[model samples]
Target: MHQDLITLKKICKPIENDLKEFQLEFDNALSSEVRLINSISKYIIKNRGKNIRPILTILSSRLCGEPTPNSYRAAAMMELLHIATLIHDDVVDDATLRRGRPSINKVWKNKLSVLMGDFILSKALINMVRLNDFDALKQISTTAEKLSAGEILQIEKSITRTMTESIYFDMINQKTASLIATSCELGAITTSKLEEDRQSTHSFGQYLGMAFQIKDDLFDILGNESDTGKNSGGDVKKNMWTLPLIFSKNNMTRSQYRLLNKLLNKKRKDGHILKKIYHMVEETGGIDYAKNKLDDFSNRAIDSISSYPNSVIKQSLVDLVGFNVNRVK
Candidate 1:
């Protein structure tokens, strides 16, 4: 196992029992009488990645106050929503693998995958209603809207090929940061119900999420499929502009810009073209620029939580931020 993953386990040691309870709630929430749904749900459970959102939810709750049954329910609901999004995303991307296993669409086909995503979304809704917290419901509903809007905006930018640094940050803020922000906020809502705690954790999550998305974008250029668990250069292949490419575009000479445009216009790009693009971005310091932004967001995330008194949970949250920055996958 990667050392970062090992450190993650240690960071979660403070909330191990809380995580176990959350697992029980999460498993219970996925149950269904329909055989196909059950089978798909089992497969999802088996193939799920590190339950990062739930961990954030639970840890935030602990940070605010003692964990409650409602905290677990909120955690489970967040995980269900996250899973539903992934299922839909795979279908949209025509992806064959997820978390290093055959994607739902690959095994079950797109139609079934879409339906399964809906079913899981319905389950998430059920969990939300079970919480009976109006604030939680409202936050999650808004987050759901943001998630859809973020994805739609990405698709629009990809089609128009008009992505900028500001727009890139905006798209990721909506698409990725919103859910994580809500995850932390929900924890405070379900536990301490303190506005200060809520604001701090939400800010923390938003910053961390921004950094997280940039890291994933970096992986698209620099990481291999084995390490990333998804195809590298996917953004380049799809003509989806990410931070490195976007930064590099500003620095490119007229001839280099033409070459980039030529490569992007191609119906299919060979590995040689891909390698050249990678080197282009690297030489222009695009990778370093993105890394600097990532570190900025990470430092801001740590600063967001500095007001909280020191504790194992507080340190765990701090470690979580570092873990994200250092994570290879």
Candidate 2:
């Protein structure tokens, strides 16, 4: 494992027991009578990623105050929402793999994948209802809408080939940042009951998530499947323009831009074409541009929480910003 990932483990050390309780809550949230649903849920749990969202929820809660049972439920709800989106995204993208394993769509086909995604989403909704906090319900509901709208907007931009830096940010904000923001806000809502604290953590999570997605954009070009556990250059393959390609488009010459567009418009791109596109973006300094933005957002995230008193939880939140930008996968 990468040292950054180890750093994440250390960051979670402060809330190790809370995370354990969260795991139980998460497991219970996914429990169903249907055998197949149970099997798939088990697989998802077994193949879970870093549990970053839940960590954020728990940490944000601690930073503002103590975590309550509702905080764990909120955390589980956030993760279930994220997982549902990923399952649906794989089906939409026709992706075969996720986190270095065959995707749900690949294993069970798109039809089943779609239904399972719906099932998981329903579970998320159930958790949301159980929260019984009007403020939290509103926040989570808005996030759900934004998540769907973000995906639709991305698909629209890709089909129209009209992706720009502005649209890219808007897309990521809705699709990714909104959830993280809610995770932090929900933590405050469940515990702190202070609007100022809620807003602080929300802003922090929003900036961190923006940095997170940009890092994913960089990984698409620079990272391989073995490292990223994802299909590299997937955005290019799907003609979904990301930050690097979007930033580079204006910097390239007319001919270079035309050639790049031509390749992107193709129904299929071979290794050579993908390599050429990567070089075009690289030569125009797209990679560096993205890294700069990643750092900018990371700093913004840290700044959002600057007023909080120094403590292990606060330091973990700060470390999380670094981990998000530095993680290899």
Candidate 3:
């Protein structure tokens, strides 16, 4: 994992510099009468994330042709939208921690946290309008809607025992993958005139996003809480259906299914029961099966990017997919 981060640093150095510049611009752009909004926004920015979405946007543009001012703007917009979603998600999840730190709702009241999320989302949309690109605005707006719908679907299905693999895939695709696909497509569209390149870039982002989420699902079952920077077995606690749990349930005997169903239906907090469920999932090859699916999605991501001309940017994008697959937490 250490070596992978080092390699990622080398691959992402140039893009990181560009991303930093964009971040500066983004910080400068956030001005409003709401001082509390600014404070919350700054707090959110203080704990920097992996910047995967913005990096993808910039790198996709460069791989298609050359980086431009428009690409930088789009990248900044993408990050803003993502951060806003995180704020909203933390609220929805009633999560106490995010990225290993106290979540906004934990620090402040839920009302303030919810308002902050709305403020950030409004800022992102305003910036998108400033870009004055109808297509970009439309794409981002649609992605945001899909993300909302997906979240609702997941919440509705929480603790459901009958979730199918197809439903799980569909949920992740909408919840996690669509925004990523938009980032790449918007990046290419900002820098390139070729429709084919734009489509391919979107495909690359979609596959990569799928792989990324699948890895996250695996981590939920197998990762340490400290390593993942979130509560381990959070999905299990929420009774959210994921690929691993779905596969494991399918392979369980009638008696095993009855036991698992009882645990799922308990509606009570019990660590021992959760651990038992985790062990059952592992014994059923749930984690391994999810990993294999991640492998397939990662390969598809690589293939989607392979169509582009060779460059450091392309290689970096490919390496990102590799990192996503191998990431422990």
**Model 2 lDDT tens row, 154-228:** 999988878889999999999989999999888899998898999999999999999999999999988888889
The estimated TM-scores of all candidates read 0.98, 0.98, 0.95
Please give the RMSD to the true structure for each candidate, in Å.
0.9, 1.0, 1.7
- CA shift at 255, candidate 1, in angstroms? 1.6
Model 1, span 1-329: residue lDDT tens = 78877988999999999999999999999898899999999889989878889999999999999988999999999999999999999999997767777888988999999999999999999999999999999999999999999989998999998999999999999999999999988889999898899999999999999999999999988987788888888888899999999999999898989888888888887778788889989998899999999999999999999998999999999999999889988
| lDDT per residue (tens digit) for residues 50-129 in model 3 | 77888899888888888777788888888888887888888878988788999889888789878887877887888788
TM-score of 3: 0.95
Which ranking of candidates, highest TM-score first? 1, 2, 3
Model 3 ranges off by over 4 Å:
1-4, 159-161
lDDT of 3: 0.83
Cand. 2 TM to true fold: 0.98
Compared with the true structure, model 1 gives a TM-score of 0.98
